[model samples]
Every structure is written in structure tokens, then in C-alpha cells.
Target chain A: MDTYYKPEHLSHFASIAEGNKALAEKFFSYYGAVFADGALSVREKALIALAVAHTVQCPYCIDAYSQECLKNGSDLEQMTEALHVAVAIRGGASLVHGVQMLEHVKKSSM
Target chain B: MGDVPLLPTWGPDVAGPGLPAASPRAVRSLRSRGSELASAETQIETVSRVDLSAMPYAGSFERALRENGWARLEPAPIEIFQINLGKLCNMSCRHCHVDAGPDRSDEVMDPATVEACLAAIDRCGAHTVDLTGGAPELNPSFRTLVDALVSRGKHVIDRCNLTILLTASHRDLPEWFAKRGVELVCSLPHNRRRNTDIQRGDGTFEKSITALRLLNAAGYGKGDPGRRLTLVTNPAGAFLPANQAAMEREWKESLEREHGVTFDRLLALNNMPISRYLEWLEETGNLKRYMELLVTSFNAGTIAGLMCRNTISVSWDGRIFDCDFNQMLELPAVASDGSGFHVWDFDPAVLAARPVVVGRHCFGCTAGAGSSCGGAIES
Candidate 1:
């Protein structure tokens, strides 16, 4: 029922940043309760953390969880593989829009 | 290029980072508006490697909000972890926001730090692990990290650089990932080689195609069955990306028909201006133009679905950030006692609610088809 995200260090940060008050309180209130040594592995948490990072784009969370991914004993190669999913998604997002250009290009070329 | 208007709905004029030589009357008008308060500091500096003036006045928020209409909005956190291992990458693209390259070594994530990461994972009991790097494959402990997570039964994601797969050490990577069932996400920039290679590098397009073939042989990118492979795309300049569904169809058909390559999906991204991109804007005298475009395209839809609401970024050194772009700027993560903004020290609730610091560069994510770690701003 406990997690590292609920550490006292979090309180120190919340008090420092006016913006984090509500987020900190809400996240902490329910964060630790989610994992009460249920039918889950720490590796799953790393993956979930990673996905959430993309969902939010938190650099600090990415930095912290990347190492957590490894320490949980996730293999080196797999770590790269997992992270690529995020980069590929991020990078592909830009290219997917070339469609607007494609129609314009064809019409102009004609 | 389309039967276009003389003035694009999203175009602006500029000489450099800003408008050139404001007229006396214009300057007086600007001063009258009190926006001069923000630009007064911009005058003292030409372009410093680091500028504190741009740092938003955090102190004024408590005062300014009561005086105006600014109020912080908060969101809940989703349970998937996608960490940006570092900004260090093998390539320094013309528009790379993090300015990652072979020369960048400051944010490298080490093995010991990863051990701590593992502890957090176990402590959190998450079910998915997404690892990314400059070329995440370049991480010395990349394989170990993957194996560890797989051993724990978490789904693994790889932000692959297709060129890396061509390297001798990574030659067996396709098969290696196959064995581990790692989902492969590669950057293709475009379906056409010319566009991709030009933006990534001279040989990148060809190498990416080759890598796709290798992945296909490993059952990746094949729409038919087996493991998954995906490709990414983004506009080449400061502009909005095309529609996602239309582009994905074309990419699938072209890659499959031409190269016999297959992939599960295509992701479209919006390029934010930060490191190299900011430099690009300054050089091409498009900074103001780009900013205007971003403001013009600011979608309330994008603001509501911003990646920061659900995801949090971590630096290679185990620090925290609202997003990867913010990480490169070296901004503090929540300003903890003026110490370091490391993500490790923050409480999830407080950190999640914290109002994110925005900069001129944030325009990239807020522009048309807003971009973030999730590819496109779908909502």
C-alpha cells in the first residue's frame, strides 16, 4: 500500500511550488493506496510510470523512472525497446500530418 | 502549396527572433499597454546561452492571480510510465528540441540510478515500462534494463533509432527484441526517403528502410501478425502536422507496397521550439512568426489533453520535469527549496497539481495538432 512517489520529499516540493499543491495532495492521497502488495510486480509499475510520463511529459519523472526501470531489473535492451515506443509515438505524430501536404503537392504538381 | 491564400491563416512577419526595429510610435503604444513590463528585460540581453529573465516570475503568481483571472488547474495521474532516459542522442537533427547529440554527456542515466528506478517500480507495482533515450538502444545497459522489466512481466517499449539497428552491435537487436516481445517504435519522418533523410541525416532514410526490413523479418511492422512495430512523423518546420488517419493510411500503403515493410500504426508529432529548434527560429528570423502561429493555433482541446496532465518526464540524471522539452531548458522541477528539481524527491499528488512553468518554446506543443510524448494531441 506504499510507494516511493509518496515520500516526504514530495511534501518539501509541494510547499515550494504554488502550482503543485492540489496535484500533490490529490496524487498522494490515492497514489500509495493503489499498490498494496496486490497481484502485481514492480516491473509493471515501471512500465506504467513510463506510459504516464508520455501521457504527461514530465522530464523529472522520466529521469527517475528510467533508472527505476533498470533497477527493477528490467534488461538493458528491453529498456531501449520500451522507451522507443514513446519516441516512435512522439516522432510519428509529426509525420502523420504529411497528408495535408500530400494532397497539396499532388494538386500543385498536376 | 494548395490553391493557397496570399496570407496563410497561420503566417506572420519577422526579421529575427522578434520584429525588427519597432517604430517610435509603435514602441510608445507597446509601453502604453504595460506589456513593456515583460520586454524591458528582453532588451538588456542579445542572446545569452542562458537567460534568467525568461524565467516566469513564480513569485508574482500569488499576487497576479488575485489581481487577474489566473488560476491553477490540476489533473489525475495515469499509471503508465514512459521515461525519457536522456537528451543525449546519436544524431543532432536540425529541429531537435533537446539538442541531443554524441557530444551531450551531462544527462546520461547510469546503472546505479537504474537500480533505484527498479526499487521504485517494485514499490509502485506498475504494469508497463516504456524506456527511451537519444537512441535508447545506445544505452550501455539497455538490454539489461529490458530483460529486468520483462522478467517482471511488464510490457516493454523501445524508442528505436533505425540507424542503430544497422550498427554491428545492434545487428541482432531485431531478433533480440523478438525473443523478449519488445514493441519496436522507429522514426521514419516520412514515407519518402528524401524527406526523412534530409531531416534526420543523409543516409538515415535508407538505413531506416533497411532496419524496417530487418524488423519485418522478425515479425515486427507486419500488419498480419506477431510482435508490433510503429513509425513516427512530424512537420519539417514550424508548422502544424497533417491529419493522422490520412497520413497513417498512406504510410502503411507506401512502406508495404514499395519496401515490403509493414507497421502497426503511424504517430504524428508537433515540433516544439527549445534547443536546436529555438536556434533554428532565431537563425531564420521566424521566431516571431512561429510564436504567432502557435498562439493562433492554440487549441483548448490541446490544453485539456496536454501530456503533462498524465505523464511526467525524468532526466537522465534521475530528475523530474513536466515534459521532455522543459527538461532540456534545465528549469527547476517544482522549485524545491531552490535545490535540485529531481523527480525522486517529489510527492506525486503535489507534483501532479503543480502549475507547470511555460516558456515561448511551449508554443510547439500548443500549436496546431499539438505534440507531446503521446504523438498527437488527440483530444
Candidate 2:
């Protein structure tokens, strides 16, 4: 109650399905299928999910996937490297947009 | 054999002071610290004291078994005789369930007990003789015992912490074991240095790699049945190990690619909630959560393949237990008349009739993929 985000809220995530069971079940089913091992290992998927979690800035996904990554045999070094991938992409995304400012300045200048 | 060191040095460089100062969690054994938890009774009380009202299955390992239709967990025919040579380890690992360290040198098995163990191994009809300890190689009679077991034509397994193989006295172990065709089941927490060093001491992963390369040079991990080299891994934290087969594939690739090291197989194990690990769980405030996780993740299918069902653990002093964890807690296997059993009194038929002891810590073996000394019980 004191804060906007309660740590316990992560465990209560399934409760969101109570209002729309079918839709929630479908989404969860897709989520489970997505994480299951395939050509990319479960460990790899967990690391990818971890990187995407950071890119999207989802605290719940970050918390869940951090444990997921560790449980799947990814160490802190690998996790940190995965996080840097997110950082580079996010930074690169912003830096690429600098060309817009550059173009506008050149066009507007005398 | 003439050039090999017959006696362990027990020097500061070889024992207690070898731990790197960077590791804050590394400490002397609980026995040396005079901790109440050093007593098995206190450890049992500590495990039971945790509140589990909100947790699934109420965190009772026995009830979890009963609910899963295992009313009385009984043993299969004995196949492996695991001997705990002593508790005098060179390193004080943070997650060690044995509480073994240099301070525990007083607990090593004497020559008389080693002779008794050999006599028991002869009578017990078990095909495999597993030697374990703080570092089994540190025991003075380790080679003598191994030579005896090998002469009996029993499969010998040295449960080695790889760092011991690099020590001054024990450096020739790889070649010695190779000549005898003894299987080396070494502990390497992770292929990566950071995770491996975090659980063990700093510089451990490098030492482990060097040891593995020595093992490779001596014809281990090269797909030979006799000279099999198996690396065991446990998670560095409170979580369970990942899938064993998958982890083995990844380890094979990484250790080979990164270090050019090779191993025949990998056995992923779960950290048990007892001894030094129990101390860490309590210190880190993860005891309740970890116990809950173990109970909730319990897999009923693993019950039939439980190592205690086929393994008899003999302590350094020749006391017998259903498993190594129980041995650490001082829970001796009892005879039908409720008398404590020892290696001197080992009777395979009598042992096969006894029910395996159950405790809250037993959940460590049953959780998720289910862990045993040999590795994952199922899958």
C-alpha cells in the first residue's frame, strides 16, 4: 500500500485471468509455448526473455526472468552481457534518431 | 609411486589459510566455531522451526511422500558403498553440505576404520566403492584404501574436489587414478569463473580448469568407459539446477570452446539444505523460501530412483547412514532391534530390510529433477 509496486503482486499475476478466463488462458498458453525448448534452448529463451524484459522496462518480467535465467543455468556474467545487448539497442535506437535533428538544423539554417 | 608424497602437508598453504580474502562467505567449519547448529539435533530443530503455514504441502517431507503414495520408502538391493574418508578439506566452500574444512582434520578415518570398511565392502556384495570426504585425497590412507578396493575388483569412484588434484601431495592423483582405471567424479560448480568462484573460493575455477586439463592429458573424459570423467555441478545460489542433459551439452560446448577442456559427462545436482549450506540459507534469510521451493517443486516420479534406496553411506568413523546428508546430520541407520549400525556390523540383507530415514532435508533430493550423489535421478 505504501508503494505503487508490491513485490507480491508478481505472484498474484494469474488472478488477472479471473475476469476473462479464455483470453488469459490463451495468452498464457502462448507464453508457455514460446518459452519451451526448441532450436533455441530453454536457457537461451530465458536469456532472450531477460534481454527483452529490460528493453521493454517491465519490472514483473525482469523479476520473473532473472530467476528464470538463473534456474536455466545462465550465470551473472551471461545475464549482464544480455542486459548490455538491451542497453546497446536502446541507446542505438535513440542515437540513430539524432540524424532527424541534424537534418532539421541543416534545412532551417541560413 | 616412489616419487609420490606419502603424507599430506597440512600446511597453511594447503589448508585453512588458502581461502582467498575476497570471499566474505568463506569461514571455518561450524564445529570449530562452536556453533549449536554443529549438533545434528540442533540442525533438525532449525529445519523444523521454519513456519510453513502459507506454503504448499505445509513443507512436511514425510507428508509429501505419504500423499504421493510412498507410505514406507524402502531400499533396493545395495549396489554402491560410499565411504566418507574424512572432513579435512583444503577449501571452505560457501555451499558445502558437509561443513568440511581444514579445521576438521581431527575427524579423518583411522587405519583401523579403513580396514573395517574394506572388510565390509568385501562382504556387502556392492560392486562400486565410492570414496568421498572434505577432500578424500587428504586422508593419509586414501591410496591404501583405493588399492584395497581395486584389488577386490570393485569399481572405485573418487568423489574429488578438483582443486585437491592440484595440491603438492595429491598432484599425481590423475595418473594414479588413470593407472587403476578409477572413475573421477569431480565437482566444478560452473564452467564460468565468476559463478564457480562465488560458490567455491576465488581462483577455484582456474584451478578446476587446470585439473580438468590434467585429467584430459591423463586420458579422462575421452569417451573411454574405464577412465570416465564426470563433472558435477550445483547452482551457486538457492535455486535448483537446470536440466541435466541440456546443461551437459552446453558445458561440453563452453568448456571445450573457451578453455579447450573436455569432459565425458556432466551431472547436475541440487544443493541440500543442511550443514554449511543451511547456515548460509539462514544467514541470507532464504531458509523458508528455499524449503518452500523444494517442497512445492517435489516430483513424485523421482521417489523410485532415489539414491538412498540403493546407496549406503559410511562415515569417517565407520558409522552407516541411508545417505551422505543423513550421515552429516549424524542420523545412523538402525538395526531391527533399534541399535545403531556401523560398517563393522554391515550385513547387506539386514540393510536391505530397513526403511530409509526421512527428514525435511530429504526434500532437497526430491525437488524438481531430483538430485542424488550420482546426479539427477530422473531425466
Candidate 3:
């Protein structure tokens, strides 16, 4: 009976569309932790958002995280550095599979 | 590209006391050229259904847009137009907000309607001409519109669905766009094929990559200055776009290292509630939570920058609106009535004097980072 969504038409968000009370509570908990200090400042969260954004791989998430990073006083340099970490991990994850190929090649050559 | 008729000729009402009527679209041009947009407030209030929302999400959307005016920008430099030529798209992404698919034909705008739209563009003097559709390329006249507009020195933006490129008939689309200097605004939902496929359908992400590659080969997104290219990001469900600037860098780095793809900028857009998204909310029963996200993230600062403030949305059928969002909902384009030129009559002086009709939906733009055609309006 509650009508929150308007009809102008763009993709809706997960949290908005799911509306689970449990999730809301969890969000309240994590949202606090997300901003709270634990080796990550508000500025750092912005950078992490930029990095994790790619890892989780949501375009909307990336957009939000990028802005959050900027607002927390992180400059472009810090943001890019964070994204580099993601790129390195993502790239390394794919390349590391070469171990299987290497073992197969060794067996064949033998 | 010049000399080609981008739109029919329409003169400003101020040019002379009594110039001929332009077209219905000319009435919609009020979003741009602020001086001419709000000269007549009372007339607009009388003719159109002031509010168009089927839902009662926000209390004061119209009031906010009227006060802030996204479509009211100088010459209206709208970052994204997201023009829906009609509801007829080739691909049927489940999360499509416009509910565009091969089946939805009732809303499609014909070619004559497009010409009327061209006239409105001239009156508004908007900088970017964003062409969208079921697949904008699916429309026979899509090419002509781009060719005509680009020639007239307008920035033509096309929200391309990648699959269109893979089709045999659309094979030369990349070249056609390149020849016209059209900015290829594309979407992939997620770089990972599985994620994209789950939401968009099987093989979508792969074909998207192929389309992107074609664009890259055609000099789009390849770290080149001569060609302009951009990508759009919207959440699968209700959420604000991931931070645009950093996201842009991430997209550039990952796609390049993996697929040798690169583009100029990445635009993050928040999803609004309309069409297919509405159906999704109803079918899955998640409407309440989605609204909370929008309300919680409502950025008052961003509201002033909502795209409708300065951008005028012209429907495929010649109706005008403060933004494309408003057009989909059937909100009548506000008209300025100084010279007695009504909705269909293009009188610049009269058109310039109209006040915008605001509604509850305007809150979508006011939310965090403030949504606009390009991205965040304030940040």
C-alpha cells in the first residue's frame, strides 16, 4: 500500500527495492561501522569505496564511492591509488590461474 | 554537418511582437533559456495536469524543481539527455526503467514528431542532443537525427545497447556514429559477464564487449582527444550511482587492462521509479525499502542541480517537459503565455514566461550528490 517509487523510470537500487526490516537494521549497524574509525577515516572510506566498488562491481556503487572519497577530502591521487589496489588484485587473480596451465604444460612436455 | 536542417525554423517571440507559432515543442523549450522559460506562470498552471505521479513518494517535488530549475541552465548544458525516441528497444533488460522492449510500441514517436522536437531544440538552444530508444539505432530515423544535429553543431549523445552493434544490419553503426562525431554513451551493467547476463540476459555482456571494441577500434574510449566517448552506470536495483569520478578511473583501468578499452568519462546516474522499475518493485514487493534509500540519501544541495532545472525534455510526440523523467510520466510541458501562444504555439516571449509545474518526484534529483543528466549536479 506504500508507494515510494515514482514513474519517471530509471533503474532502482537494491536496498530500495528489497526493503527488508532485518536488512535495514543490519544497514544501520554497518552504516555506523562504515563511517566509524578502524584504520579507515572518512577520507579513507572514500578511497576504499573506489577500490571495493570495482571488486563488488556495481556501477552505481562506484559512482557513490567515488563521490564519498572526494567529499572526505581525498584528492584524485588517493582515489586512483585505491582503485590501483583493486586493479592489481583483479588482474593478479586472473593471472594466478596460470599455475594450472603451467602444470599441464610441464606434464605434456615431460 | 551544417546546412542540414536540424529542426524547423522557429523565432523567439521577442524578435518581433508577432512572429508565427513555432510548434508544440517550442513550448517545451522553456527548460533552457531561463529568461524566456518562466515569463508566464499562470497559463501553464491552468492547461496541464500539474502533478503526474501515480505514487505519492515525496511531498514537494514540483516546488523544489520550480525553486531550483535543473532544466533552467543557461542554454541548458544538460550532461545527459537520455532521450527516449519511443519505448521500442531491441533488448529487454529485466531492470529496464523505461520498460522498453521489442513489444512496447504504444509510446514510440514517429519521424514527424522528431522534426517537431528538432524545432524545440533550436528554441531551447540545448548543448547536447542525447538520442535514446528501444534501441535508438532501431529507429529508422535515428541516423538522420544524429546526422542532422551533428551537422548543426550540436553534441549528439546516443545511449547504445551493445547488442545492436552485433546484428548484421547494424554492423556499420560504429562507423556511422564516428563519422558524425556522436558520443557513444553505452552501458554494460557489470564488467563481469555473469552479473551482466543475469540482469540483462545471456550473452549480453559479451556482445556488449564486442560493441565496445568496435567503438574503440572506431576511436571511441581509446585515450584519444579527437574522439569523445562516455559510459553510463546505474544500479541493478534502487541506489545512487557509484561515485562517478573514481568509478570512471576504475572502469578505465580495468576495461583497458583486460579488454584494451578506454573512455573519456563515466557517468553515474541514480535510478528513478517509473515503468519497468515500477513493475519490478510491485512484482518483488520491494517498493518501501527503495523509497527509504531515496529519502535517506536525499541531498538537499544536490536538489538544486537536478537535470530538470536547466534541461527541457521533448517527448517523441512533440510534448515538452522539465526533464525526460517528467515526460515519461506524462507531465505536460509548462508553457509561458505572454504572447497568447499556447502549448502547440511556439511563441518565445510567451514561452519564456512560463513557470514550471513541480511534483513529488523531483526529490529524485535532490538526493545525495544531486542527480542530473551528466551526473551529480553539485559535486
Candidate 4:
């Protein structure tokens, strides 16, 4: 109760989700499929998951995916590059929206 | 084929000056049964005459490999040709297997041997050349070897101790290294100053930080294709490292915040209990426990990534070995003629076909996530 999140709480997530058993089963099955090795290796997927975790700012996912990336044999170089990918996208998304500001300035000047 | 200078035998006392010697009974037991002990222990007799009867395990490393379903531990095609340039290092760390120091100048590789090594590399067609030493840069012919390797488009790795880069004569090395596209793998035992200073020496962490800043200014570790910098870390204590990805994140954030230093990656390695580390373990009464820990934590998953499979190790005096650890212990690579092999007699096919020489110390490589020069084997 003193802390908002304990590391042990991560293991209990499945039980909590089980309250809605049918929905939980469906979600878990799909989740398993999403992470399986395909065109991208488990290592590559782990890196992607790590980037998305940072972009979304989820503490839980960040913790989970960090271990996953290492467990899949990805080194620090690969992980750092993946983090930069998220940073670039987030920064680029904001900067690209500046076209609206430019359009508004031209219209007002006219 | 000339008479090489005989290097000094680095005994336990030389490695750690104040450490007490093993008991008289232990020394006698090792000497009296040296042959049987050598066969059982899987390590060659200590060149310095330090009694190894104190080694906790009496079991054979070969037996463990066989019991685990391996016919024999064999080498794969050669890719990385690793050379131990010599034992002349500026800082003599307490746990160095090489027993390297500023006073180890006599052990350096001669130019003729260096040329033979280059010839071997050309013959083997190895894609990478990994150079190590007391401080490899201390070798007079080190730059010449690097230039030769780079000219041949070989990927050269300098296993550097960061503090060495701060030495007066070698100050401009960071720029020289970057221009050649050499992959710099610098050792930094920990991100924090306290642990690093304790393992290496006082003020070492500061010098390492300064050296890292110099490297950063030279465009190393800034996502440049040509300038790659890797930080190597080993635990300061008796345990295996925690997850590497988690540690890398911590290091990246701490270094950037505290020192504004950046590295391309971090490689967390395990401390193998050998030579100086073995002396420390014996003195601290952790020898038995550490051996037990290494043996018990052996993971089958790590075997596929064992560096000995793809790496060929050559010593300063032209002797070749299966790995650097074996090179330190003077265990030659398994040769068909049963004679010691050298860079001059280099043959990749022969090396790949021979079984790797395994000893009890090899348990260090298979424990937990496993360890190699490149870092962990099993993720």
C-alpha cells in the first residue's frame, strides 16, 4: 500500500485480468501471438517493444521489455539505437505539426 | 626460430605482494602429485610454481562436458584472431590473470613475432584481430600492428583499460584510434567511482572519466559508423552480473548525467577465478564457494556461443592457444602432431578440426549467463 507499484505486482497481473475470464483468455492468446518470433526475431521484437514502451511512458512495459531484450541476446548498442528511434519519432511528430503554425501565420498576414 | 627472452614467472606473491602463501602441506601435495593433479584439474602446471592444490574442485572439466552430452568441445571456423601482445600494463589490478604491470617490459612481443602474427592473419583470412596486453598500447610495435591489420580491411579490437589512454606519451591515441576505425573496447569495472577505484587503483576512475571525455570529443560513441566505443564491466565482488540490458540503461543515464560521457554499448563480463583473482579468493576464503557457484550455475544454453569455437588465441612469443585464458595458463591449442603450434605454423583447417583444451577453470565460462571476451554467451 505504501508504494504505488511493487515489482512483485507484475506476476499477479494475469490473476487480475482473469476477473473477466473470457476477455482475459482472448487477450492473452493474442498477446502471445504478437510476441512470437516471425519475420522479426524475438530479440528484434524485444527491441521494438522497448521503444514502444518508452514512447508510451509505461513503467511496467519498460521494466518488462528491458529484461526481454537482454534475454533475447540484444546488446546495449542495439537497445540504445531502438530508444533513439522512439525519441526521433516523438520529436518529429511534434515538429511536423509546426506546418499548422506556418499556415496560420500566412493567413493572418494576408 | 631464435632464442626468445624468458619472461619472469609471475607467482602469487608477485601478483598480490601482501597475500600469504598456501600452507606447506598444500604445496607438498601439489608438487608430489603434479602429474595426476594436472590430468585431473585440466589446467597445465602453474608456470610460476604457485601450488594449485588449493583449488577446491578435484573433478575434471572434460568429464563434465562429456556427462552433459558432448562428445568433445570442438572449435568452429576461425573468425577472430586474438593476440596477447604482452604483460606490460600501467596499472596492475588485483584480479588480472596476466599479472601485467609497468615492470613487465621484458615480456613484450618482439617485432619478428609481430610480423609472424600478421602473416598468420593473412593466411587464416580472419575477419577480426583482437589485441590485448598489459596495456597493449605500451608495446612499441602496437601501432605498426594496428596499421597493418587496418590496411588489410581487418576489424581490429583494442581491449583497452581506459586509464591507459591518459598516459602522457599516449595522449593523442583517441584521435589516432578513431581515424583507423578501430573498435575500442575499454574496461570500466563499474559506472560508480567507488567500485571502480577499489578494483583498479585510487584516482583510476577519474582518469578513466577524463579519457572517456577525450574519446567523446573525438567522435567515438556518437552513433558514428567508424567510431565505435564499447565499455566492458565485470563484477567487483563474487557474483555474476545482473541482466545486461538493465545495467546498460543505468550506465547510460548515470554517465550522461554525471560526466556527459557516452558509449555505443556496455558489455558486462564475469570475473574468472584465476591467478590474481584466485589468490584473492583464497585469501578471502571464497575459493570453494566461488568454484561451487561456477560449477552449479553451468548452463547448457551457453555452449553454442562459446568464443573458443570461433576464436584463435596467439601469445606474444608466437605460441598459439585455444583462448586467452588457456594462453595465460600456457595450454597450447590442440595440434594434430601433439607439438605446440605457433603463428608461423598457422592453419585454420587444422585448428578447426582439433578439440578445444578444457580445464576446471573453464567452468568460469559456462556459469549462469556465461562469459566471453565479447561478453555474455546466453543473452
Which candidate tops TM-score?
2
The C-alpha lDDT values of all candidates are 0.63, 0.90, 0.62, 0.79
**What does candidate 2's lDDT look like per residue over B172-267, in tens digits?**
889999999999999999889988988898889999999999999999999999899999999988899989999999999999999999999999
Task: Supply the TM-score of chain A against the true chain A for every candidate structure.
Answer: 0.60, 0.92, 0.75, 0.92
Model 2 C-alpha lDDT per residue in residues A1-110, reported as the tens digit of each score: 58988888999999999999999999999989998879999999999999999998899999999999998889887998999999999999999999999999999998
Residue lDDT tens for model 3, A1-110: 35643432224443553658787777768777877645644556767777988898766677667656544334445677788899999999999999999999999995
Model 4 clash pairs?
B89-B134
Q: Write the residue-wise lDDT of candidate 1 on A9-34 in tens digits.
A: 53265464367777778776676666
Q: Give Cα distance to truth, residue B91, candidate 4, Å.
A: 0.6
Over the stretch B1-379, how does candidate 3's per-residue lDDT look in tens digits? 7897785455444343454232211111112224221223322232122233333334345443444444542223433334568767777775664556676566677787777666756765667777876677877778788877887798888888878899998999887878878777787765445446655777787788888888888988876654677777666554555456655666677778987767788776666665545545444555555655565565657654556656666666656666776665666555543222222446544444565555545556666776666766764
Give me the overall lDDT of model 2. 0.90
Chain B fold agreement for model 3, TM-score: 0.75
Interface RMSD of predicted model 4: 8.9
* lDDT of model 1, residue A89: 78
Higher-ranked by TM-score: 1 or 3: 3
lDDT of 1 by residue, B1-379 (tens): 6787766354334444444522111111112234322232331122222332323332222222223333653444634555677656777566665556675556678887676666556655556677787777777778888899989888787888788898888999999999998987787777766556546767777888898899888888766334888777766555556556656765677678988888898878876655555555666676655655565565546666777656556668887767676666666457434444453555555565567765555556756677776677863
- For model 4, residues A28-65, the per-residue Cα lDDT tens digits are 89999999767765667889999999999888898888
Instruction: Compute the lDDT of residue B193 as modeled in candidate 1.
Output: 61
